[model samples]
Target: MIRKLAFLIILVGLGFAGVGGWQLWHGSVKQHETMKKAQALTVTKKDPVKYKDWDPIKGETIGILYIPRLDKKLGIVEGTSPDQLEKGVGHYKSSALPGKNDQVVLSGHRDTVFRHFGEIQKGDDISVDLPYGTYTYVVDHMKIVDKDDRTIIHSTKPKEELVLTTCYPFSYIGDAPKRYIIYAYPKKK
Candidate 1:
């Protein structure tokens, strides 16, 4: 009986290992392909409107985001989604655009969407290439605000800046109460 039980346990362990290995292999392959496609994207320069003026990203598409500290370079999307964020970028309607008014707020997933975001540090370089031009920003600060903190997401400052948001505590299994927010200012156009 002991031999049979031990043998069963070993088999189960091996099965688990196989499953884990397969998942890791699959994830790496998918990210590699995504990186290839993202790298081939056509990037645009940042178009800066006058301080009080406004202009949305042409084509309503942000090609990609390059962060030196992150493990992956994500592709930006027009809409928010696990799929879109997983690739590297997402859109938030309420936030302003490159040269638009208010904060250029955007949303992304913590682990899958903007996974490398967890590695972002103050002063890190964040380069966003829009249809009009490339907008560069530097990480200034980060905080975990509650979901009700609409004021953070509802900024209307007439300047070039970026506010990136995602659920907090990267590995949190349940609905997150606080949000992980990164504040960056436009460093270059």
Candidate 2:
């Protein structure tokens, strides 16, 4: 009877590991595909007048976020839903896009696309490449706030700001209680 119980426990453990592995593999595939699509959408020159009226649906890759310090470039999707984030970093649908002279908000899972988010710091250069143009931003500051903080999404009107958010306690295994917010402003020419 003890042998049977041990076997059952091992089986269950293997089952969980298999599921976790599969999820990680699936997420990697989705991220790769999303990045490919985003790269295709990027243009060589800035053409604000070309895609000015472009609108993307949820899960659609809208741009590429470049973190110079991290040497990372992640695709940016249209919405912050789980499905969208599974593919790439999510851009809050209601937030303004680059060159809009307003706040642009982005979010990503702590374990995946933003795994090294904690390594980012003030003064780092971040850039977003869209079909219309490539906008560079310099990290201005960072803060930790409750997960429910609504002020994190407010408009910066007349100023083009980029805000990146990820779950805090980067080492935490589950949903984090707080959020790590990175505030950046457009890099002047």
Which candidate has the highest lDDT of all?
2
The CA lDDT of each predicted structure is 0.68, 0.92
TM-score of every prediction relative to native: 0.67, 0.96
Error of 1 at 21 (Å): 10
- State the weakest 10-residue window (summed lDDT) of model 1: 50-59
Clashes of 1: 8
TM-score, prediction 1: 0.67
Residue 69 accuracy (lDDT) in model 2:
86
- Assess candidate 2 and give its TM-score to the true structure: 0.96
Please name the candidate that would achieve the greatest TM-score relative to the true structure: 2
